[model samples]
Target: MKKFVIFSVVFLSLILAPILFTILSPVILFSKDNVIREFEKNFNTRLPKSTVSEKIYDDYGGFHNDGMKLYKFVFTAEGKKSFVSYIQKQKSWKNLPLSQAYQALIYGGEVKDFSGNITGFGGFAKEVGLPKISKGFWKAIGDRSVVTARFIDYENLDTKTLINLKSFDFYLAIYDTEKGVLYMLKVNT
Candidate 1:
């Protein structure tokens, strides 16, 4: 009886140790500012010097089992606008266009507009002021378009990091004067 109890205890401890670590580990250590640093390092883009605005909202389990805490930052650079976020619960980061973030900032209240195709896939388009122009107009400009960087977890939800990590997907719709062209850029890092 004593041997059986000892064996059970040891087996249970071994199984539960990793689970406990996963649950207790911080999902995200980066904040809105940290996201800017990462973006600069990876993309070679510079953020505006002016103070960027940020708001935190709950994801309601949209991105993960424990749900996500989204931080939205708004700023303008080179006469263009942009936004970025650090998804705490999802352990990922995102950069959005200024217009989309503004729209959500204004009418959407605190709720975020997530893409149906993927849980954490969505971003803002550059603000063009006019209705029709802002919808997808950035794609029309040779220089502007909606861009998204996504990180997905492919393993058991209980695990701290997803297994079988996939390549990152960056999407952009470039608009020439006559028509719009969609471009998908896949990169592995």
Candidate 2:
């Protein structure tokens, strides 16, 4: 009877160990640290302690392999300088056009004026659940800021590729040199 009990205990432990580990491990563990880790892993960069504000929405389960992982980091002057320096060093990143930025980041539902001018910035703030940017946000940063971006799992980045994407993984970093504000976005779907 004791031998049977011992065997049963061993069998249960063997079966439950992995399940517990999967539940306990940091892979699916949602926290600020995990958000930072995921961002660092993909962008090959680090976050500074001078962060002003950050919003992270990570629903990507490790084994489940679904849902979106979104992170937005708003940094102080010192942090912006530090991050911008890092981005400037990377060869993969390119200067993103303002029109493309509007389309990609904003997605859809924009309000335009009679002269074919964009009166409203669009639907990303409401739809994607990211932090909201003011109407003047793009215009304020457009000239002074350095907007750089790079796409993951894509060989060529074009209008068609950006439009036809069913799944995406990419990074965009904008540094307002004058305001000393840095905005970094990492999206995986």
Candidate 3:
């Protein structure tokens, strides 16, 4: 009986391995149109078509097989305040106090790990009235702010928004008193 069980288990493992890998771990393929589609599909809202944006792909882990691609769109709103004001109106997103929000984010969202640091200014930093780049925009990946919990664990709408912040990728989007824009960010795992 022991021999039979062992053989059965081994046989099953060998047979299922290929199928499991192919289904569980898939190579993701996408584009701007795909991004808009995915964003709309996931968020249940239309991704605004008017923004100027592009797709960025970075080869990761020193291998072509390990890579990630994401999208970025700069708004025509002109300043941090305008951008923030626009996004604030999104009911799906909740703005949290940046300093305190980091520690609380891990418990509520689909994101397993989130961390970030203030990096520097965007190209529009000067035009946006940023005197110091770091103080204006924080450059970070795995951003903790502007985060939207993408992974849904329960069907309840409350559960989906239990966290106070909303970010699809939480790519940095900070605007200060002068509407100084500071945020450079991207992350996926």
- Winning model by TM-score: 2
Clashing pairs in 1: none
Better of 1 and 3 by lDDT: 3
Residue 56 displacement in candidate 3 (angstroms): 3.5
Residues 75-98 of candidate 3 have per-residue lDDT tens digits of: 454544465555557654434323
Superposition-based RMSD of candidate 1 using all C-alpha atoms, in angstroms: 16.8
Model 1 TM: 0.25
Q: Over the stretch 1-189, how does candidate 1's per-residue lDDT look in tens digits?
A: 999999999999999999987876654443456655544454334545653524334333332222222233344442133322212122222222323323332123232223322222222221211112222222111111113222332111211221222322222221111222111111112
lDDT for model 1, please: 0.31
C-alpha lDDT values of all predictions: 0.31, 0.50, 0.38
Report the alpha-carbon TM-score of model 2 versus the true structure.
0.49
Off by over 4 Å in 3: 1-29, 60-67, 77-86, 96-188
State the displacement of the C-alpha of residue 132, model 3, in Å, after optimal TM-score superposition.
13
Q: What is the lDDT of residue 136 in candidate 1?
A: 23
Residues 35-68 of candidate 2: C-alpha lDDT, one tens digit per residue: 6665556555677874544555555565435344
Best by lDDT: 2
